[model samples]
Target: MRTEFNWHLTAWKSLGRPSPGDIIWETELLNHSELVMRKRAYQNSTLYATFPRDPCDSYVHCGGNGNSVLNSSLICQCLKRFVPGSLENWNLKDFLKGCVRRKPFSCRNDGFAKYLQLKLLDTTHNWINKSKNLVECMAKCLSNCSCSAYTDIDVRGRGSSSAIWFE
Candidate 1:
């Protein structure tokens, strides 16, 4: 079944105050994820910003464990040691199935993969400890059978939250 969703646009001059602008526009397309603009008397609409400025900017564009590469026809690829869950679907430009580990995880030898310069996954339901360093975080995550990913919240090398996720 096909599901329909709606996205509403609104402008605010200040907190809880609506703007009485003459025109406001926001649009999304295949090439451009989003475009927003505003217009007033005798003037062309001024574009605010174009979303997905980079191919990677689009939310989960490459699905889990996939990387979105800019300026490439083959935009998405599975991470190292992972393979497309559905190879046929991936080749057909459908990545919703995401990627899967090439081999089943072994607790005795399993370890986290270091992905640099990545926008971490959602943390709403993940575990977090503010007083842990990266080494401590890794140790904690490694001890848990369910832990899937882990990282130090602050990237500056200073002590920060240890964020961990479970599958």
Candidate 2:
């Protein structure tokens, strides 16, 4: 018997347990929806791995205000309504400095974009409003000129948590 866990599963019944192997095999999907399997490691001597989880799992892997989309050729991409800071870098595979707003926020005419299936970013520059509902949280975030994004994060027992980020 092998204990295998899959980190990404779109549905429950669709789940398939990985087989136990001293040699680990992992798949990394590229931009064109092509799947490439790479031998990650041998579970001998020590068991450990590296960061970014994969090339696509790094914070701002696509640069500032940019997102690293999984299974895409241009993994790092500016969020909706934004443009890359350096188009040359973006095309040349250098995603260090992420993105810039397409239109400057008047603060009065700005709206929030909804995103799904993402890992929580680092909370170093976040503001937590525990009591606010999603609408209230959006309003709270809207008042601050620096608030770049907001979300209602669920906290199992404690309920939903309002998290806002300043890019």
Candidate 3:
């Protein structure tokens, strides 16, 4: 008489937040029987075998709080993909150079056009428009070499002020 031995595979399961820098490589198997096999690896060369985990039981968290600087950094990365020479450390001088290169007569009355409205810190304002004469304003700055950057004045909300600056 011959006896047959049955070998049962161990079912893998996971619950909880994924470790930092853990990347899922592949999902080899999944079934309605609540059995699954997932291959994952961490940044530090550690391997993990994960299985079906309860979605409600696991907490997916994103790193880093949303801040202006962080947001700017992300935007810079996006810009780099399109504009190869664009730098994240753009200062007033760099910005002015770029503007001049793109539109040399931007400072002239016919050069600068209405860009758009920008709302910041709960204040709403049109960045450029005809009433304030954006073209003339920019033209004046261009005439004076000392001006590096120019921003429109706030017209809406609590503190409305029209102003220009040079550096």
Candidate 4:
């Protein structure tokens, strides 16, 4: 026997996703009563998930260790050499807690790894250099004993931009 469980859109929205999320509405939805949608109607069945779009677009949606790469098979994977911070939660598909490094950073022994097209992490605690090229960025980041990561950017939102992070 198949058990039916119903989840209301309002209940999901109450969790802080203020918008309707990334859903594609059927053409017929145009004819549906606006009150049904405005009233938190999941019963319309005229909407469906648009997987090309995503719901985890906020900063650090997958916590600190998991990166939210749009269109990837796994939006929340454990970082290299790391493990989920809570395997139980991961198994339960609750990826919010993200992952954790298996080994802590050892300043003198650590090295940087680079990937293409990855966005910068949280910036409230980082320093930005709008004119530094990639080579110069690395030299400066490596020269700093506390630097953990560096990336190309123009935090000023103009001109050249690069950044280094503190572990």
Candidate 5:
């Protein structure tokens, strides 16, 4: 069943639009179980809906860890929505490369604290829920000259949050 589903997903992905059968099957799958319905949330929130081309092959293999699937899907959706043009044209690999790049700096007062509020304004308006804690952490990072970038450590659960500092 998983292989068949994957084949259909890949075919639909290649076509750039869901076929009637795909739609029917998807609707049936979503209607059959709550878990499937929850999975559909990831599909509905996808930014690839607007794209007219196939995403990178990696897209199909998303949600490796059960805990991070939802967040991973959300991130993938954001990538598809914010970056203009087809996935083929977008330099997703490079974008992530830049994010992970480390620059020399001093973390004079660097330390990890729990429940630190941070805010990440989804410029693309992709992530529906605004994370105040994420926003504040981002603000803190921006205010500090030594901070390179901030990312969440825990993406699961309602109040999950964490940040990474580069020096």
Candidate 6:
């Protein structure tokens, strides 16, 4: 059988289980995020597979405002203008506490910082304005105090829409 596991922002490409003729399949949710699967053959042999090959592939792996630093020994880093939410946990290499803004935000004085080549966070709780361009998107987010981040709907396309995060 073929199966797929999906989340708000990402999904596993696909998983193909063994043919049913002589195999039995079982799946286990290893933790809050990881999933493991095993196939047992009638011959007393078993094959196993695990989802999310790395920490970066897990949902909210680095927590909010934390960027998963890929291709390095480092697992997470706070975004520009932000600091680790918990310095003690950060020192221990535990990023679950995520990040916090270095300075308090003031609606009129705060401005957005440009970030390039980032894999966006989960957008399940965001707002999408299809009619807004990049500039207009920035204005909208700026107008709303709750806005945290904004980006083009299609980063690699014509950018005809905007998606804004409010968390």
> Among these predicted structures, which one has the highest TM-score?
6
Clashing pairs in 1: none
Error of 1 at 34 (Å): 8.7
lDDT of each: 0.75, 0.66, 0.32, 0.62, 0.34, 0.74
lDDT ranking from best candidate downward:
1, 6, 2, 4, 5, 3
Model 1, poorest ten-residue lDDT window?
1-10
Could you tell me which residue pairs clash in candidate 3? 107-138, 107-139
**lDDT of candidate 5 over 64-117, digit per residue (tens):** 110112334333322211232234422352223112112223456543333333
List runs of model 3 lying over 4 Å from the truth. 1-73, 77-133, 157-161
lDDT of 1 by residue, 9-87 (tens): 6556566767755455566444323665555455555556666577688767888888887787888988888999899
The reply for model 1, stretches above 4 Å from the true place, is 1-50
Candidate 1 at residue 104, lDDT? 95
State TM-scores per candidate: 0.69, 0.64, 0.24, 0.58, 0.22, 0.71
Model 4 residue 94 distance off true place after TM-score fit, in angstroms: 2.0
- Per-residue CA lDDT of model 4 for 43-127, tens digit only, reads 6544333222344545466777677765876667666766888889877767877787788877677777666555567664578
Relative to the unseen true structure, what is the C-alpha lDDT of residue 93 in candidate 4, on a scale of 0 to 100? 68
Candidate with the larger lDDT of 2 and 3: 2
What local lDDT does model 4 show for residue 46? 46
On the 0 to 100 scale, the lDDT of residue 68 in model 6 is 88
Best by lDDT: 1
> In candidate 4, which residue pairs clash?
130-160, 153-161, 154-161
Q: CA lDDT of 86 in candidate 3?
A: 29
User: Could you tell me the TM-score of candidate 5?
Assistant: 0.22
Clashing pairs in 5: 117-133, 118-133, 118-134, 118-135, 118-136, 118-137, 119-134, 119-135, 119-136
Instruction: Identify the superior model by TM-score, candidate 1 or candidate 6.
Output: 6
> Could you report the Cα RMSD, in angstroms, for every candidate shown?
7.5, 9.6, 21.1, 13.2, 15.3, 6.7
